[model samples]
Target: MKNLGRVTPATALVLESLLSADSVWGLQIVKDTGKKPGTVYPILERLEAAGWVQGEWETSEERKGPRRRYYRLLADARPLARDFVRAQRSKASSAVRPTPAFNEGGWSAV
Candidate 1:
């Protein structure tokens, strides 16, 4: 819609998805958006490099879960959400199936 610069629509979906949730792993994002991880991970890396998102290893002992990298939108990108909402409220574009990239039938959620 607007000048997304180097960031593509896939990147936006990733950011928006994280903004909607607390934090999510690289693969879960793929599942949620039905996009290939090959495409999704790079976007995540770019987002992290741009400081728009942050990823960290998560450790949990309750279920003995392995370390997982979780991503969340940075503080700076938080304001953009409101602006996006305001813009979406007015303009109508339903064909925009702006989901993240992932291999739909290739992987199972772990």
Candidate 2:
């Protein structure tokens, strides 16, 4: 797989969603991540371009709506995707801080 470059929070969310299943439809990922379609689609495209993901159009005619594109992480890239997701989660958790309480003078961490 090629370098994925900067992995944004949206991209991390997408990766997390993908890791949860063997294959996932793009819309399902959008719903799973609660991210906009605009945000999720591009990330999927980028992942596919980077060789980390493979997307295939649904061939079954039994389904109703528009043909859904199912995406799956390349076998060799799964471990790296997991590592990226873990790192992103670590950063996100570390970056979060409790809301500051208002003190008599000003705001305080306590």
Candidate 3:
């Protein structure tokens, strides 16, 4: 698998959503992650480029709608994705935690 480089919070959410299903359509991912199309599509693109995921068009004559592009996580990428999600969660929590602030006078709660 190629390097994923940097995964923003939105990208992390997309990866988390992908974990729940065997394969998912683009709109479904947007819905699951509560992210806009602009944000979701780029993350999917990166995952696909990194060999972490595979995407294909859905073709069903019985269904009457536009073709849906679906994505599935690569078997090799699962463990890496799990680790990434955990790390992102930990990083996010730490960012939200209060930290002490230092001033000229003294240290204070933040």
Candidate 4:
């Protein structure tokens, strides 16, 4: 499997959602993570490109909506997904702090 270079917070959220699901379509993931299509699609493409996930188009004849692309995490990548989530969580926890408000003149450190 290709190693992922950087896992952004948004990407982490997408990956986290996949962990609980057997397989999911693009829009379902967007709803599950509350991420916009613009954000989620690119992340899905990245994951598919990295070989961590596989995607296929649904071919059922009874489908009612637009053909959905289903994405699934490769069996071998689940451990990596777990590790990535843990790392992202640790990184997020460490970076959590109150944001400094802007002053009248310009942006302030406080």
* Per-residue alpha-carbon lDDT of candidate 2 for residues 1-110, written as tens digits (9 for 90 to 100): 89988899899999999999999999999999999999999999999999999999999999898999999988998898899999999999999988899989999886
**How does each model score on TM-score?**
0.64, 0.88, 0.85, 0.82
Write down the RMSD of candidate 2 (Cα, Å).
2.2
Question: CA RMSD for every model?
Answer: 12.7, 2.2, 3.4, 4.9
Worst 10-residue lDDT window for candidate 1 reads: 1-10
Residue 83 C-alpha lDDT in model 4: 88
lDDT of each: 0.70, 0.94, 0.91, 0.90
> lDDT tens digits, residues 8-30, model 4?
88888899988978899889999
* Predicted structure 2: lDDT: 0.94
| Superior by lDDT: candidate 1 or candidate 4 | 4
- Decide which is better by lDDT, 2 or 3: 2
What clash pairs does model 4 have? none
> What's the true lDDT of residue 97 in model 3?
62
Residue runs of model 3 more than 4 Å from their true location after superposition: 98-110
Query: In candidate 4, which residue ranges exceed 4 Å CA deviation?
Result: 97-110
lDDT of 1 by residue, 54-76 (tens): 89987775756576789987777
In the predicted model 2, the residue pairs found to clash are none
